[model samples]
Target: MSFLKKIQQPKFLPNFLKVAIPFFVLVTIFSLAINSWSDIFAGDFAKVAEANFNNGKWKAFFGYKIVFSAIYGLYITNKNMK
Candidate 1:
């Protein structure tokens, strides 16, 4: 398909990764820091997992990260193409 061909261009993957990887890492770290702040302060790191599991925060965090990263990557890639 034409869309596939466009994305197959040599620069496409590098351009997407250039924006996506760092963004994902930074955002993920920031999110983890925020979410674990209380546990960190209390020095009870084990509770972090229990809280996240009970509240389903982990699912939301992972979902948002994956979705946003892909969207941002595609947006940047398309912008670079133009």
Candidate 2:
């Protein structure tokens, strides 16, 4: 068999992940939506975490979570490519 034919038959994991990863993400979001959608859509500006970190300073944990989650999502996508 030729090299190209060999590569085409027993495929690599990246090829599987190319489809599986995105589908996993969509399912995760759907699950989260179904679980805490009430709290999400209700616009609950509640203190979900402790803010006080140091001298006269407050950390916006909720905002931090949102930003971190976005970064993590991107990281997961890039990880699969490699």
Find the candidate with the highest TM-score and give its number. Answer: 1
Candidate 1 off by > 4 Å: 1-5, 53-57
The residue-by-residue lDDT of candidate 1 on 1-72, one tens digit each, is 354776989988888989888888888878878878879788887887776645777788778998899889
Q: How many clashes would you count in candidate 2?
A: 0
Give one digit per residue, the lDDT tens place, for model 2 in 1-82: 4434433544434554555556556655664456456655775424211122233333442245445555554455444442
Model 2 clash pairs are none
- Distance from true location, Cα of 54 in model 2, Å: 24
Candidate 1 weakest ten by summed lDDT: 48-57
By TM-score, how accurate is candidate 1?
Answer: 0.71
| Prediction-by-prediction clash tally | 0, 0
